[model samples]
Target: MVQFEAVLFDCDGVLVDSEPITNGVLRQMLGEAGWALSQAECERIFIGKAVRDERARIEQETGQPLTEAWMLAFYVRRDERLRAELKNVAGALEAVIAAHGHTAGRIACASGADKAKVVMQIQMAGMAPYFEDRIFSGHDLQRSKPAPDVYLVAAAHVGVPPARCLVIEDTATGAQAGLAAGATVWGYCPQGHGHAFQGLGVARVFEHMDALTAALNHKTSHGNLI
Candidate 1:
């Protein structure tokens, strides 16, 4: 059994399986600009980062400024192109909604996604109603993952103390954020990212989202510190 008053989730990997779609978006956009990005290159540079951070890396590599004007144009074009490919993280809707529905403490999602995109994805997945007013965008926080700002803000929104919360994260950065916030964290372990959290400080890690769900539910069901 786990002891916590609230649950917080990361959006991209934990709430939705949008990473590959995101990589595809980045790859296509970069490709059009004559920058040939292989799949490995996309994962290395873009995965697990806010778009702006990814853009910064792009700028660093390309040795040119990616202006606001350029970004605005790209967003406009990309949104239309990536619409049909949006998807949810496995057991995301089920896990968060189920826990929120049953537990006394509230459940919320903190995402690196921008607010507009957050609305679009969650609404498209029909997960908005579950979160309703409890959703938080990384833009709203002073810092993104690995800084604890987003998760801290979400915990505050849920009316719980950080120590009393459990965070679900898929990225090493997101898990770091939870740890920085002093929350108990469970990493949604992705294969091949072995030992990513071994020293970063997560309370637990699980390869299966179902396993994470079961653990959280087990803790809740047993009235053990939840």
Candidate 2:
């Protein structure tokens, strides 16, 4: 079994079901900007990514500049919808609790998202207490996911080396970040299909939060190592 000193969580799809809500707002805004796209196409292009990260594509498709003002407006609309529609991912609370115990409180939320949005969603899902001040956001770093900066910060903040941490992520981008940080990453594929994570080097691809909890509670009680 893998012995991990800490557990790092990704906030969006892993803990809170906010991806669809956020992506919906993004799709609508893109459509209004003259770039019509189906919800699946929008998600496929943007999920697990920061909006500004895809500025070129968005601007090219919309025939408009991906301006700061437009991003601000998107954030506003997205947050409004999130506030009204967000909910905890199924079994997320239980998984978090299990991780907390298994790691002896060495748990942190690290995401490639804005800190405000990540915080609000966690609080809204009633998971604020578990993370408290241990939240790290990529917006605060020079680089986001697929770069490893945020996860590196999170592992350090939790007083654990990256190699000794277990990162729970739901996207290949996130898995790349965790692996780049030198942590063991577990992909959370709620749909039970992990094709997206292929070749990402994630240690495991689990379809449910309960599976993660079970792994953390397995005989070694130190999280899945193999």
Candidate with maximal TM-score: 2
lDDT of each: 0.74, 0.89
For model 2, which pairs clash?
Answer: 2-225
- The residue-by-residue lDDT of candidate 2 on 18-124, one tens digit each, is 99999999999899999999998998888888998899998898889999899999999999899888989998998888888889999999998899999999899
Q: What digit string (tens of lDDT, one per residue) describes model 1 on residues 120-186?
A: 7778778887788778877776777678888888898888999988888877888888889999888
Error of 1 at 193 (Å): 4.0
- Superposition TM-score, candidate 2 onto the true structure: 0.94
Candidate 2 lDDT for residue 211: 73
Report the lDDT of model 2 for residue 72: 95
> In angstroms, how far off is 121's CA in candidate 2?
0.5
Worst 10 residues of 1 by lDDT: 217-226
